[model samples]
Target: MDAGAAVLTALCGAESFSAAMATRPWARSPHFFVHYVPVENHQTVLTSPAHTALSTKLSTELPTDSSLESLGVQKLGMVVPKRHARRAVTRVLLRRQIRAAMAQHRCELLPGIWVVRLRAPVDRQAFVSASSESLRIAVKAEVATLLGDVLRRCRSTRHAAQAHAQPAFQQPSTVLSAP
Candidate 1:
């Protein structure tokens, strides 16, 4: 799926958020962190201590990109904690930059549940304004770098998976051209 759709299409339940974060973060920047649980690992991760205790109805609620759903899609969630960004404007700005960065990168991201969290607050004294053009540009550049790192990691793994999927040697059929 396209990055735009991946950003907009799904809402993960609290249970899913907990399970996803249960895994160590896949990537981190100075101010942002990304956590990912690949679709293939969902069975083990989702059924971790939290989900195992949930009732059947609760289990049915899942992100669209989960293994049980359309596994090829990507589900994304963003968290900008109040403790980190005291102003509501700051939280929204962080989320906007994240979405914009994800969309800016054109590569096909690995299928998974993805979450980006704001890990630190910018120095208020440095920017002075809650929403400043300088802050936006800085955030945008940092987020783009963060996503770039993820794509590089995904590319290597994806290539390896593709290599293993296709046989190294195979018989080829030949056709003669008419003279």
Candidate 2:
């Protein structure tokens, strides 16, 4: 397997999809919601021959000056429910928009499986034509906004978790004997 695929396998296991789906949604917008699950360790899984081969292949494919260890692999799935989009073309357009938004934020995305699901239908009355340029633009804009919001929320939550994880120092109690 190629280095990219190997990295992906290491970061996202066989059941990553189900795990991602089960995770509490990280963020939500009017039309889209995002679910993410972080990868804790990649080295522990590289003991298998298949994983070793994949890692070697990835290392060779990586740039001579670059380090693959820093690379964060993530799996992504996009969903456009039929209920949300009646037309197949509309669903395809929405998926394309989601992919575009993901690509734009590829570098900034954390190492995790992410699923972008459409929860609501676009306003058909606003754009009468399913394949209109205006519809495409609107979908793309909404997807971008959704992804941005999700990322922001993820960062905030991570910070909150870290804050909570830190030990809080307590002041020693002072007792006055019947004073």
The TM-score values for the models, in the order shown, are 0.77, 0.61
RMSD in angstroms between candidate 1 and the native structure over all alpha carbons: 4.8
Model 2 misplacement above 4 A: 1-15, 41-71, 157-179
Q: How accurate locally, in lDDT, is each candidate?
A: 0.75, 0.66
5-100, model 1: which lDDT tens digit per residue?
553335367766777877788889999888988878755554555545544655557533344555566667788889888888877888888876
What would the per-residue lDDT of candidate 2 be over residues 1-179, giving only the tens digit for each residue?
Answer: 23344232222343444456667778888888888766553232222344455354665453321113543666567777898888888888887787767766665566656778788887789878887899998778777777778778767876887789987888999988995
Top candidate by TM-score: 1
TM-score of 2: 0.61
- Backbone clash pairs for candidate 1 read none
Question: How many clashes in each candidate?
Answer: 0, 1
State model 2's lDDT: 0.66
